[model samples]
Target: MTAPLPPLVRLPLLALLIDAALVVLFVLIGRASHNEGLLGTLVTLWPFLAGLVGGWLMIRAWRAPFSIAWTGLAVWAATVVLGLLLRVASGQGVQLSFMIVTTIVLGVFLLGWRGVVLLVGRARVRRAALLATAKRMSTAG
Candidate 1:
């Protein structure tokens, strides 16, 4: 198996890699032009966390390949609504378009990555089952 890539590099590698990529991407974009403040930072981070939660629910649900993607979009919408409520309570009308776009971007990135990991795991299991069955049949024959 060519040394098996160590324990840390085998399982959970995709999620870790995707998270690092998202962090770098968001930090760069948010900090660009030196105009991003605490609220801007929060806006970027909020949907990423939402995506993680949605992806987790997807894994639990385990119904379809697109489940995670749909869940992520739903979570992004909920975050926008929550942000709007906050803006209203604070006496500032919500910024709809910007929040929607940014949250969707973050949500899709995180959720998509997690979905890929789950799919890969499922595929591996299926392949193993098939191989086991084939081996048993061959030996019996």
Candidate 2:
């Protein structure tokens, strides 16, 4: 069997995969709403993908991939802003209404998952603490 990846490598890889999946999902939903097919969805995905790469670089997102403050906010902002800029440059429409919708939708997609992860992490920590406390009490008594 193959060896498992170290945390340094594994965390960033997982973060990138999750971020890419969310971006693709955003594109897929938007395309479906317009009754567009796969090719059109992929065509629309390029600018957003570019923005995601730019965001990852800008935030050095791998450092704290799961942190909402470090990764989630920066990634969301960069993806929406840079994505629209690239889209505009590519002669794609960037109307105000579309921008607003894109911002809200992408924000929810990107930040929502991070928020869930944060809650779960906190819960796990709390549970561990409680378990440790109980073990100590039983041993002492």
Candidate 3:
């Protein structure tokens, strides 16, 4: 058996990393053009942070089922919608196309990673089960 990781969470940590990366990207681009206003900062930070938290929740909720693709897609769509609504609330002029694209990319990556993780974990479990069965058969024989 593989040793357990530290008591610290793995998914949320991953989520934070993703959030930070995206936020930095947005900040850099905004700063480049001097468009990094308070509204822009809010728009960029809110979605990214929310995405991280949402991704963490989705992973935790569906970790057992391990269906990354669909769950990731769902969470992505939901979070994007949530983010856009937030933007609307803040009176930011957001375009629908932008939201769609953002949702697609984020959903695929966030959920896709989880799906891959689930696949690897499942494979490991299956391998372990097969090994145990083989051992049992050998001893029985």
For model 2, where is the 10-residue window of minimal lDDT? 33-42
Clashing pairs in 2: none
Strongest candidate by TM-score: 2
lDDT of 2 by residue, 31-94 (tens): 8878768778978999999999899999899889888886899999999999999999989988
* Candidate number with the higher TM-score (2 or 3): 2
Off by over 4 Å in 1: 1-28, 35-74, 91-96
Off-target runs (Cα >4 Å) in candidate 3 are: 1-42, 47-74
lDDT score at residue 113, model 2, on the 0-100 scale:
90
Candidate 1 lDDT over residue span 62-125, tens digit each: 2332345554455444444554455466565346665665566666664766687779989999
Model 3: what TM-score?
A: 0.57
- Which parts of model 2 have CA positions greater than 4 angstroms off? 1-4
Return the clash pairs for model 1, or none: none
lDDT digits (tens) for residues 30-141 of candidate 3: 4456566876666566755565466547656334323555555555565666666666786766787767666666665656666667789889999999999999999998
Lowest lDDT 10-residue stretch of candidate 3: 61-70
